[model samples]
Target: MLLELRDISVNYGKISAIRNISIGVPEGQIVTIIGGNGAGKTTTLRAMSGMLPLQGGEIYFDGKRVDGMAPHKIVAHGIAHVPEGRRIFPDMTVEENLRTGAFLRKDKDKIEADLEDVFNRFPRLRERRRQRAQTMSGGEQQMLAIGRALMSDPRVLLMDEPSMGLAPVIVEEIAVIIEEINQRGLSVVLVEQNAVLALELANYAYVLETGNMALEGPASELHDNEHVRAAYLGL
Candidate 1:
C-alpha cells in the first residue's frame, strides 16, 4: 500500500472527530472518501498529511510510520495536499505561489522543469503566470492551488473538496484534470461531498458519517448499493 490508516482517531478538544477509522490506498490508484457535512472526510486527509495529529492509531506511507510528522516533512516525503478553500497565496503571482511548494527542494533545474510541466498541464496557469492569484476566479484559483501542489512533484496527492463552490461546468473540468493526473501515475486520495462524481472517478471508496466510517468497497459496488444511492446519490 502507498498509504494506510490503522484505527486512527482525531480529537478536537474533548470531542472525537474520528475513531478507529482505517483506510488504505495502493500506489497509482484514485481512492475517495464521500459523505455529507461533518463526516470527518477532510479530517482524515488532514491526519494523513500530518496537519492534524492522530491521538491513536497509525499512518504508514510507503511502509514508514508518519502519523505525527510535521506537515513540511510530510511534503518532503512526497505527499502534497491541495487543501480545502484553495489556500493559495492571495497576493503572490502564480509563479511565486508555485515556487513556494518547492521550498524544500534545492535542485533548481528540476524545479524549473517541473514548473514548465505544470504550466503545460495547466495552460491557463501559464497564461496567468504573472497574475496575482487573488484576482482569479474560484475555479482558476483551484487550478492554481492544484498546480502549486504539483510543482512539488509529489507521489501521493491529497485533495479536499476540490469541486466546492464552483459551477457545474467547472466541477466537470476539475474531474477531468483529476483523471488526467491519475493517468500520469500519481496516487490520489480525494475527499468530497459530491458522491456521484467521487464514485465515478475513484476505483475504491469509503463512506463517512459523522466521524465514523459507514461503508467501504469498490466504487462500482458502492454506487449500486441501495442505501448509498438513496442517501448520497439521491436516486
Candidate 2:
C-alpha cells in the first residue's frame, strides 16, 4: 500500500469522531471511503493529513510512519490534501493560492513549470490568474483547489467531498478530472457522500457508518452488494 491507516482512531476535544478504522490505498489506484453526513469521512482524511491528532493508531506512507508529524511535514512527505469546502484562500489571487501548495519545496524552476501545468489543466484558472479566488464560481474554485493540490507534486492526493455542492454537470467534470489525475500516476484516497460515483471511480471501496467500518470490498462487488445498494446507493 502507498498509504495505510492501521486501526486508527481520532477524537475532537472529548468526542470520539472515528474509532479503529483501517484503510489502504495502493499506488496508482483510487480508494474511496463512502458514508453519510457526519459519519467521520472528513475526520479520516484529516487524520491522514495530520490536521487531526490521532487518539490511537498509526498512519504510514511510502513505508514511513507519519502519524505524529506536523501537517506541513506530512505535505513534504508527498501527501497532499484537497480539503472539504475547496479551502482556497479567498483574498489571494488564484496564482498565489496555487503557489502556497508548493510552500515546502525549493525547486523554483519546477515550481513555475508546475504552475503552468496547473493553468493548462485548469484553463479557467489561467483566465482568472490575477483574480481573487473569492470572485470565482464554486466549480472554478474547486478546480483551483485541485490545481493547488497538484502543485505540490504529491505521490498521494486525499480528496474530501470533491463533488459536494456541485451541480450534476460539474460533478461529472470533477469525476473526469479525478480519473485523469489517477491515470497520470497519483494514488488517491477519496471521501465522498456520492457512493455511486465513488464506487465507480475507485478500485476498492470502504464503507463507514457512525464512524466505524461497515463494509469493504472491490468497488464493483460493493456496488452490487444489496446492503450497500439499499443504504448508500438507494437502489
Candidate 3:
C-alpha cells in the first residue's frame, strides 16, 4: 500500500471527530471516501495529511510511520492536500498562489518548468496569472487550488469535496480534470459527499458513518451494494 491508516483516530478539542478508522490506498489508484454531511470525511483526510494529530493508532506512507509528523513535513513526504474549500490566497496573484505550493523547493529552474506545465494544463490560469485570486470565479479558484497542489509534484493527492457548490457543468469539468490528473500517474484519495460521482471515479471506495468506517470495497461493488444504493444513491 502507498498509504495506510491503521485504526487511526482524531479528536478536535473535547470532541472525537474520527474513531479507529483504517484504510489503505495502493500506488497509482483513485481511492475515495464517501459519506454524508458531518460524517468525518474531511477529518479523516486531515489526519492523513498530518493537519490533525492522531489521538490513537497510526498512519503510514510508503511504509514509514507518519502519525505525529508536522504538516509541512508530511508535505515533504509527497502528500499534497487540496482542502475542502479552495483555500487559495485571495489577495495574491495566481502565479504567487502556485508558488506557495512549492515553498519547500529550491530548484528555481524546475519550479519555473512546473509552473509552465501547470499553466499549460489550465490555460485560463496562464491568462490570469497576474490577476488576484479573489476576483476569479468559483470554478476558476477551484482549478487554481488543484493546479497549486500540482506545483508541489505530489505522488498522492488528497482532495476534499472538490465538487462542492459548483454548477453541474463545472462539476463535470472538475471530474474530467481529476481523470486527467490520475492518468498522469498520481494517486488520489478523494473525499466527497457526492457519492454518485465519487463512486464513479474511484477504483476503490470506503464509506464512513458517524465518525467510523461503515463499509469498504471496490468501487463497483460498493455502487451495487443494497445499503449503499439506498443510502447514498437513493436507488
In model 3, how large is the Cα lDDT of residue 44? 96
* Per-model TM-score on C-alpha atoms: 0.98, 0.98, 0.98
RMSD of each: 0.7, 0.8, 0.9
Q: Which pairs clash in the backbone of model 1?
A: none
Candidate 2 collision pairs: none
lDDT of each: 0.94, 0.96, 0.94
lDDT of each residue in 12-126, candidate 1, tens digit only: 8899999899999999999999999999999999999999988899999999998889998999989999999999999999999999989889999999999999898889889
Candidate with the greatest lDDT versus the true structure: 2
Per-residue accuracy of model 2 over 1-235 as CA lDDT, tens digit each:
9999999999989998999999999999999999998999999999999999999999999999999999989999999999999999999999999999889889999999999988988899999999999999999999999999999999999999999999999999999999999999999999999999999999999999999999999999999999999999999
Residue 50 displacement in candidate 1 (angstroms)? 0.9
- Over 37-96, each residue of candidate 3 has an lDDT whose tens digit, in order, gives 989999999999888988999899999998899999999989999998989999999999
Give the C-alpha miss distance for residue 93 in model 3, angstroms: 0.3
